[model samples]
Target chain A: MKKVLNLILFLGFTFWCFAQDHVNSENRIANRHCLDCHGQRVYSFVNPDDGSTVRKLMPVDFRVDSALFYTGAHHIFKCVDCHVPEYDSFPHPNQLRFEPMYACLDCHGGDDTYAKYHFETIDEQFQKSVHSPETLNGFTCWNCHDPHSFRINQRTGESIANTIAYDNAVCMKCHFETGSEVMLLLANEKLKPMSVSHDWLPNQELHFRQVRCIECHAAMHDSLLVAHLVSPADSAVKQCKECHSRNTMLLSSWYRFQNIENRNKNGFVNGVLLNEAYVIGASRNEILNILSLILFGLTLGGILVHALFRLKMNKRKRHE
Target chain B: MSEKLYLYPLWLRLWHGLNALFFLTLLVTGISMQYSDIDFPLVRFDLAVTGHNIAGIGITLSYFMFITGNLFTSNGRQYRINIRSLFSDLLAQGRYYLFGIFSKQIPPFPVTLKSKFNPLQRVSYIGAMYVLFPIVAITGWALLFPETIARQAFGYSGTLLTALLHIVMGFFMSIFMIVHVYMCTVGKTPLSNFKSMINGYHEAH
Candidate 1:
């Protein structure tokens, strides 16, 4: 009896250890340690170009919504992992800009790392993007995705709805409403209105909710990677055939954010990815459709010829 | 004068009407979803999805009703083809439609108590209901619950194959609908067969 009890106890202990390894809990307190000040109204700065004084609450000014941070990609990371020594001290010096504004390439730079998560191409693509060649001041990854807010392996387990909302929020942060840092930044540059009106797209809001704005605005290619280069408004994918054709971008966009293993050599974006929900033209099989159309045409022709023959036979019988 | 017979009983008529309604709705919604990006979609893409799902449920239920009704009634007997002469009879019927009918040759076989459907009709209906209909329905439901499909042995790629099969079968079913409607007009009077369907009576000439 004692031996059996020991075996059961050993099994129970092993199970507990396995469970602990699988469940990764976010260290929210570590974030709060920094937010305790950043959350309060303590920072202000005068814009050199616009002559406007920018003073606001720490979390709000920096666009750090704590609630969002808790559920974000970096939730599992400690604040110290990305921060510099200057940020560790209290009452940070006035001259200190955001210390350790880590660029995406710091870790995800080399070809090996980029092959895993192809953000390197995004940098190359951005140069030719619609915002290119003439932004009053240039921008980088941090302009759109703040390193603190951005998380690695972002879409591994996220819901499609949540993923879409998060993607659009990144773009709309500057483009939708005024008074946003992004808007202010764009305005300061003296660039054209970053805000766009996509009246032509059917069910515009639903499309916005279903897919990222970058999906259409970016350059077209075999891979789902959004070319960081924003296309000019006129160059946007205006022709429906671009997506409705046999090769559709909508079919592959969802595959881009997933693990690299999902892709294969046979030109399938998400190799054998079975979507529960259909995306209109995206689900159509061109070969099968063409074959069915040919069948329909032949059947129609046969019927018409048969009808004419019958008509001729009946007319002759009447004459007889 | 034509011989009047009460061939389509109440249950058969109900099943036929319900099947027609469901199939038409499924086709419209399915086509709309397939071609939504083309231009001026028949219905909004989201609404098309909603309608297709509802119609799919209706089809599933009606399909069950059809099978059950056939089992319980004499109507099921109409679909049973005699294997001994099936091939020859099918050929004869093919000739009747293509050459004999235009030449004013009389029909080889007429509707009787034991055989309501001629060889061609029987083979087509059996293949459609038993083979094609089930393939389309099973695949459609599989698509609706993709998580279940992913869990199965076939996994993700299997789900794509299922969707492809469903779409191809759906195309055939549409063609069947067109031919079936046209055949309805092939009776002595164009409206004769249509009236018989409504009143549960078929006239034998």
Candidate 2:
């Protein structure tokens, strides 16, 4: 009986492990988003009249056009960069340039010049990212996403680097790693900034996981501006002052606030970046949680001690 | 004492009981929702959050009901705490709880048709109704429907601020629970007020 039970338990565990993968939204034997890699044109919106989703739930249809795809300019790019080797084949290579999220890093090398002093210092922070080493793997600068389209956001004031996906779009794609699409929802709930371990894919709201690290610590690449132009007036300081208000204000001693004399073309310095400020903004609840934990532990321990000791005293008094 | 007659109104009793029940539910479910863990929730995590949301809304509704009932009815007299008598009321109640209660003496403050609650009780109820409850209601509503706050602000900065408020208010409510429970037991009988809450009547035995 014991041997049979152990075998049954083993089989049950294995079955459960596999079952969890299929339990999620995107991992069914069929789902629409898989049609991108599958190459079959008729997969995603199967039976459009009946309005049912079809197609084998293959890898995410990275290039498959969606309604909002046309909202940005870079939507015209071809399938070569994204679909990579799989631009021709079904099973994409693990190390290919188009290999899911990691491939994003391969295409956009960490050192691409968006601006003169593009933030390369984020390498260490990316290694120790909150998404690193626990639920998900530690990320390289490129692992989180490719900086290809700035239709969502351009860190620079100049229209130069158009490479950065919308924040939500970036998170949702990599949300399910090594699991089916349905598991993606569970992954999302687990990824919440205020995840309470038991919260599994909460339908509560989106703000929970929306504020990722890059949303704050975006590269504040430096720019150039002639401080005191003689012939032609410099316009760099006017533009640069927007993001660099604190530092520019501090540095411009002799320069008037309205004077065109000192054109501070510098973008946000490392110290003046709103990344830390935005991060601290999110830290309020985290700090609250820490304080709550301390209070809860103390309250529970005191209550337990009070009850247990009271019980012991009652027993002793009854004996007396 | 037999010569003096005071009749408690029905709406006051109803509003008080509903307020107490909803407040208790909100407190338990609120704590459960905030520090939600598999180890100790009185209900499942999802259900706990739902209950907190519902109970929080219910408490807000109950507060409005209580105040409305008070305003429309003569039971509003219970809220009228005199500043001059405040210290005496507290001393009387404190002394009764400390020493006089064990001697089976009369309660320090007398209950009448107009003034049912002692000064301390009136102050506590006023603070709960006007100050803590409203702050909690606004904060809880904002946190619950953060998408609205996000839209209103046109910036996402308010989400963290709202969540912080929700947690802080939750802490206040949990501490209130300790005091509320202790006060409930200090009634005519240990179970007298608890039973009064159910039947809406307490006779002087």
Candidate 3:
């Protein structure tokens, strides 16, 4: 009886393991079913009343770029996971729209674990970002980063040069490319004209290659992680003196974050850092400069007056 | 008889002349480099950098010559400060410049074989040579090798700190030059001190 009971227990365990595998395999099969139609179908319509032809959601446009999707950070997820249980059905509903079918906040909002995993504060930061419009209109994450192909930057082990490249690439997708069609639709008149002539800047190529555009363009702060508010091109820092100065805006980001302890200790006493390259009229001790200037003016003035007085006295003496 | 003293030796005269020339050159080139983008143009940006670096080297060499020559001769004694009498001597010198000099009173501290500088001159010279020159040179070199100063070793950025020190020192140097030229005119004859620097002869009582 003991041997029979042990054999039965082992069988039950095997069945449970098989069930778990079946469920995972089922998700994959369901995703493939949805992709098969989405990959090939191009829904077309003709208006009989106006005798007009229209095309909507062509397979070329609607279909996921399989090559990108397979290798993307989201590749681990099946279609149903984000599309929800409503999308598990075959051929989807005839009048189904993907926009109302799924929302990004379903899993992302309200949970600490998801927030940490995503490195996203969602609405808290996005609302205050430069892109936020006066009305309830602005860019979603999908505008810049495609949901199907979004990848997390591996900043921890990457070299500084590589990290900078990765971050800038996102902006350059629109900014660097000449006559970006997507930019026209999204940014419209708000797009800042690219500075084609960098005549004022020295080593322009070196600066563009190494530094992120956000470094100078963003608002000043101790932590770069939260300073996402980008200034418009007109208001952006174009002056060399700003960075070249002792109290540079460059110190507000990466350098500041890296040297947090030192910054905290020295502090910005007079809008100047004591232990950094001092900029004239920027970061150096202002009191010392003022005192020295006063002394210089007084001494030089005194010398001139004394010389004039002596010359007048000498003339009087010589005449007598 | 108006006695003429052979005060400035040949080496001292040569060192002084070279120091003045190189310092003026450095000042001009530095300003050019600093505001290279601006409308003012004493030299082209690249040329200004080259000239500044060359002038800096020349100043460094002249400075070393002055130090070596002074170490081997009595000229070094002129800069030696008597800490005890420094404040009082400075006050007396200040008073003379303010009142006594105009009234035709004899200078309390006169230039002689042992004492070429008054108390004020000795203090200013020491500060300029030992404190200012070293700082300017070191900081200027720090900017040249940005990688070395870029890293934060201590609590602050070495590059920035060095730059600040360099600018401040340069300011003091400018003031020193202005005052030194003016004080040179305070000799028995305005041209006498200028002639002494060139020909090694000064008017003496």
Candidate 4:
């Protein structure tokens, strides 16, 4: 009886594994079918009324870059997973266009697999940010983070410059005119050019290249990977010491990944930053400072003793 | 009676005075910047930066003047080291300062018309002006225009190493200045050497 039971359980497990693979394969095919029309800039169709060919340009918002989609966090998902099943139909019903969009929490909330991401906490942070739904009429996570192409670059151990560029581009999408038609459609007012707004900053170009826009604009949070609470322009940090001092915010924000990677490495004062550019006052070594102070003190003491001896000798010579 | 020699000319005196002013300005401003604290600042941060930059430029120009003066004038001859007797010359001069001066014995190497510096003075001056000064000046300029510094060097940030090198050189130069000033008093009288720099003459025994 025991032997029969074991055989049945083994077959049952094997069938379940095969079923899972089949489902995944089918989902991938479905995703490809959707991408066939969405990936291209234009698609041709037959206008049945006139029996003529019609070339229709896909709206920018409706289009998706296949390469980016495949690499994104949602690559494993099928087109109908987050989207309505009606989208799977040919000529997707016009009502599907107005279908309520899914927020990040719609799928991630209360899910054990996404618990580590602290998506709930991030949602709370976003609610308090300047870009919150309450503050802006139609603002959502999709405005800054495109669901089609968004990837985690900071923790991927890429160069800080690459990470800065990727993250800053998200803000510049709406803040500056990068010629994206979708941005113009989403924007309520004329975008304030970054160059014009940041004119008062010294070494503006260098600052932009070296750091992310969020470093000053966002409030830092120890629990979150990146700060979501965006501050208003008047509240932004302008003091040089905020970044130049030993307790710089960069250590916690921009350089956090590098810092964690190099925390155990030896032979550097500010080892994290020592691997990249050095910030004055911030990069100072405690050991070096103490050693220099000791040396200076010794030299001064030696000079004082020598001067005293010389004074005594001069007096003796006068007596003679 | 003492024999007088024209060791410092009018131009040399003027340069020496300007160099002293610049060095003092740099030292004060540099300390303020290196150990800057918002609560207890040595000098206002902005002012210190401005002062340091101006002094740095002044010192850089002064260094060029020193190089040109040494190249074109007889003063250049004093810096040339006699490699053959260098060790012996240094020992004798060192001995005089350490023991002989206390006993009122004659100096091992006296200031002469042709030789302005004793062997000990010659070596230290060369190390300061030739080696340390050039390094500090170059690194200062590199810091001012950080784009010139290599992004990385020897598996470390080049800017950090350059900054460390600059600080070390500046520290040594400060020590050298202190010693140089004190040594001036070891002449015929405590004020005699200072007077000569002022009046362009050295009184030799």
Candidate 5:
């Protein structure tokens, strides 16, 4: 009985040690993510022209936490795989701007990185798009998804899954209502093309679908830095291109602002600074024409009859 | 003694009366078609459609009759568009009604057997004959079957676009009807023009 008891005690001790080791192994990379704000010294390199190039010393830096490496499918990637230039000094990016943003092919471009199979044609098309080279809000897979905190446990409220749920709210911020409706006059034929081309969204979709208007079209701006903004706050203005692709007379946001200033000096100005009416007024007039026709029957029926009667009696005399 | 000369011929009278009747049918049936919400035993869709089609056929056929009659008649010269004469004739007619008629003076443009229509009547009649009515007919025909066109052209066929086009054209016609009614008040008497149409005669009193 004493020998059996001793055996049990030894097995229990071993089990406890194994459990302790597993807990310690779980925390491979503890805490890492991008910093919300760069410190004052980081802004010390702003030229105000290009709005690029910055130097060290920020309170926060946006980072990919090492703790996530073990949990996510990205456990396949190394620390330097995404932040290419900062591979050596990952836990602390020694150089400030060396952490390049969203280069898809750099790690995956070659023979080994699945570029040979999964994304060969798509990558080519993506590179050719207006969104290429950082024009389109630099849309990367990261823009739509958060890799590590993709799914959450319902009961515990813990985000642990790897499948990324899409976040469209990220786009809604820029495209809320930048369009100047131009002066749509009910139903003018001249304004038909402009009005017909525009897809007016229903009120319900604004709340539920939350689809940004500019997702497909080009963003309204001269450049990224000095982009003249109607409302720097709402997403509707710039994000219309998200789906629309067509804003002719292609004045950038900066030029429109310039145009607004010229108009203001001439003693005429709209608050939003574009009169969509000029573009669509002809179409409104066309609708009015149709209205005129409807009223024609009411007002002219008697006159037509009088003329017809005169014509009829003349014909009768000729027959006689 | 007043001029009791006959101004209209037999064929013209027949054509005019039939045209007037067709217009009435069209007006009644067209209104019913627009406001389908109103229920009447006589105003079913098939009945309205039959009336409308007959009217449409009458209007189209009469269009030819009027054109040929206008071309062959000696009174055709009265319909010539002399821009200088047109402006003066319009003013003379306007003044006679506004100042002369209220003053009970003799009318400015007298009705003659040789020139049945005054300048104002001539131009408006021409527009109705040439431009306005044709638009309604062509657009109406197209709107009646938009799917056939859309199917042949776009490959996807549906009534949505056709219905929208029909409604739009219908609205224009309604607007024209309102303006047409107001102008009838401008005649020799409020019902003078009305009487003339029904009787095929205008006594230059």
Candidate 6:
């Protein structure tokens, strides 16, 4: 009986090891196969009519950096998992190129594991955004976010400036210059350059460096970690007081993470001050303000008393 | 009888008037910016900022005139203090303001030709012009060009510290303006000192 048990245990252990090896081998093969074509700086092909070799540089959108992909959020996903299975065949059929792309919700939605992320709420917000499929044709989750390399940045303990740069870069990918080929492909029009559109802003460069475009452009949602409902340009926030008042919207949005981490423990009114931001009118101490007002009041009261006494004294001197 | 002395030069009078105008502008605009509310704004937000900046520049230029005038003229001598008699002089002046003035007692250290200011006036003027003004001016310029300010100092935001200092100095300056105006009423006539500032003269009774 002991000998039989040992044999069964040995067989089970071997099968487990073999399965692990096979899974790893498949991943390696898939990665190598996809990256082989997508990773090249330039793609070369024979022109069928002329029998001449033509070299063309790969577009930024089509090229994949292997290093980034292996470390990306969707690193575990095989190419066939997201792409058409028929893409496994060499010289994939031209019809596969037109296959409908997968939205983030296609895999992440309705899953118990991803429930905490509120994918449904995100979808709801996105549907109302300017980039919604009904509002802007061909716009998708992949337009702003590249699944090949998108990473969760704000919650990664990175500096606010780094997070701002990363997030703004995603917006600038489509919104930067007027006549770039990429802009034509994505926006399908000669979009106004960012510099011209934002010329009315004071300290525009500093603002761009320190803040994300979505801070002003997106419709704020209380439950959303980052607002997704991108408002139209005409509806964007233009008032300086929006971020410069005591009840600044920034504390609820761009500065939210920092405000939570570095909340003032010394009874400071504005928590954003501790994070090295001294917004005028917004970053005032309540204690100091009250003390100042009290002092001013006392001084005024003292002056009035002094004046009354002097007037009384002068009257008595005249009577005498 | 009252005698008139040319205590203020034309340039000094001009500087003084411009300084008062600019300071008032700064006071109103600065308060508006610091305590801005959307519904009940003291001044419109953008207008306050523009007005404050213009007034700030005006004050800066006025300060420069004051410094240059004092440096090249005998007016500078008025700020000098005799450290040995400082405490006693301050006490005398403090007592005069607190009690003697109301009781019709004669001023102990009256204004004179060689001594333009009383001991208390000298010390307070020195504190305001030499110490507080320089600090406020430097910090104001630093704020105007924020890139020059340090990102952090002593574990506090450097810009916050600068702004707080500016506000404190500005508060003290406001208090000084109030007391200074009231002190002018204590002259031979209530309007006599104001006339002296206008006509570059001082009246001693």
Best by TM-score: 6
- Candidate 4 chain A, run of 10 with poorest lDDT: A177-186
Model 4 in CAPRI terms: which quality? acceptable
lDDT of each residue in A55-151, candidate 4, tens digit only: 8898887898878887777777887777888887776798877889889999889899988677888898899988888877788989888888888
lDDT of 4: 0.81
Candidate 3: DockQ? 0.16
Q: Kindly list the per-residue Cα lDDT of model 2 for residues B101-194, writing each as its tens digit.
A: 5455688676665566776778877876767777788978976765566421322235545555556766766656665665666555557666
Ranking by lDDT: 6, 4, 1, 3, 2, 5
lDDT of 4 at A168: 85
Question: Distance (Å) between predicted and true CA of B13, model 1?
Answer: 1.6
lDDT winner among the candidates? 6
Q: Could you tell me how far off, in angstroms, the CA of residue A259 lies in candidate 5 after the best superposition?
A: 34
User: Which is better, 5 or 6, measured by TM-score?
Assistant: 6
Q: Which residue pairs collide, candidate 4?
A: none
Q: On residues A80-177, what C-alpha lDDT tens digit does candidate 6 reach at each position?
A: 78888887765679999799888889988999998766788889999999888887777788988899888777556665667888899998887885
Give the TM-scores of the predictions, in the order they appear: 0.59, 0.46, 0.54, 0.82, 0.36, 0.83
Query: lDDT tens digits, residues A1-320, model 2?
Result: 99999999999998898776544323222323343444343444455568686565434433344323333333444334344535354343566753555333343346555333223333333334344334343333334333333243432232111122244445445443333443344334333232332134344234234332132223221221211111111211222122222233312321122122212432333212111122111122344567877886786665556445545654766677
Best by DockQ: 6
Summing lDDT over every window of 10 consecutive residues in candidate 5 chain A, give the lowest-scoring window: A157-166
DockQ of 6: 0.39
Q: Write the per-residue lDDT of candidate 5 for residues B79-143, one digit (tens) a residue.
A: 77779778888889777644554444666767787776767777766665566667666655664
lDDT of 3 by residue, A65-93 (tens): 54466556676678866765656553457
Cα lDDT of candidate 1 equals 0.70
Judge the docking of candidate 5 as incorrect, acceptable, medium or high.
Answer: incorrect
TM-score, cand. 1 vs. native: 0.59
- In candidate 3, how many clashes are counted? 5
> 1 or 3, which is superior by TM-score?
1
lDDT of each: 0.70, 0.49, 0.67, 0.81, 0.46, 0.82
Give one digit per residue, the lDDT tens place, for model 1 in B1-205: 8788899988888888999998999999888777765456676666677788999999999999999988998888888889999899999999899888877787877777778788999988998899999999998998776545543235445556667778889988998888888778777676888888899888875
Give per-residue CA lDDT, model 4, range B1-205, as digits (tens).
Answer: 8899999988788788888998998898788777766566777656776788888999899888888898999999999999999999999999988888888888888788889899999999999999999999999999877778876788767777888888889988998998899889888888999999899999985
Docking class of 3: incorrect
Selected candidate, larger TM-score, 3 vs 4? 4
